[model samples]
Target: MTEKDPRYRRAASAVKRCVAGEVFLVPVAAGVADVMSLYVLNPTAEVIWDLLDEPRSLNEICEHIQQVTGEAGGHVREDCSNFLTQMERMGLVERA
Candidate 1:
């Protein structure tokens, strides 16, 4: 990857928890039952979140997802981009 490639890291303040088959991101200061700051992740979003455990470029993230899902189209790229945008807005992830 090039040096200019965008890399993303999960926010330290956003803790991830998987409960009853659903993935949730709750703020560190927020109670587990708090719904206000809680973010529920869909399956694709959960996959994207899992991939962001470490810093990774958008290209790499989409490529990995595509490989696993066997999707050879632009949808993976769009989905990853949108998910990252939402994560950033929610303070669940950051550009690294």
Candidate 2:
């Protein structure tokens, strides 16, 4: 992705909770509870989630993931992109 790819931040109304060493994204709004389901993030997703506590570019997230997991750049980029896209679709994250 290019630098033009927008950075993302956690949604204003979403709350994060940890249970049994896993992180979950909980939507908190009147109709949100009914419409949006809670998202349980895996260990790798948890790393991305923590990095997303603030606005960050996809490249930045990929770099961090690579550093943390010692993975290949292309692999990390694809994985992070997919995760971010899913989170954005679920309204857990927004363009920053």
Model 1 stretches astray by more than 4 angstroms: 1-4, 30-34
| Leading candidate by TM-score | 2
Q: Give candidate 2 misplaced runs (Cα > 4 Å).
A: 1-3, 30-36
Report the number of clashing residue pairs per model.
0, 0
Clashing pairs in 1: none
lDDT of 1 by residue, 1-96 (tens): 566578998987787788898889887655444457888888778888888889999998988888888997598898888888888987779988
- Residue 84 CA error for candidate 2 (Å)? 0.7
Cα-based lDDT at residue 31, candidate 2: 40
TM-score of each: 0.84, 0.84
- lDDT string for model 2 (1-40, tens) is 4557789888877777887877887888864553257788
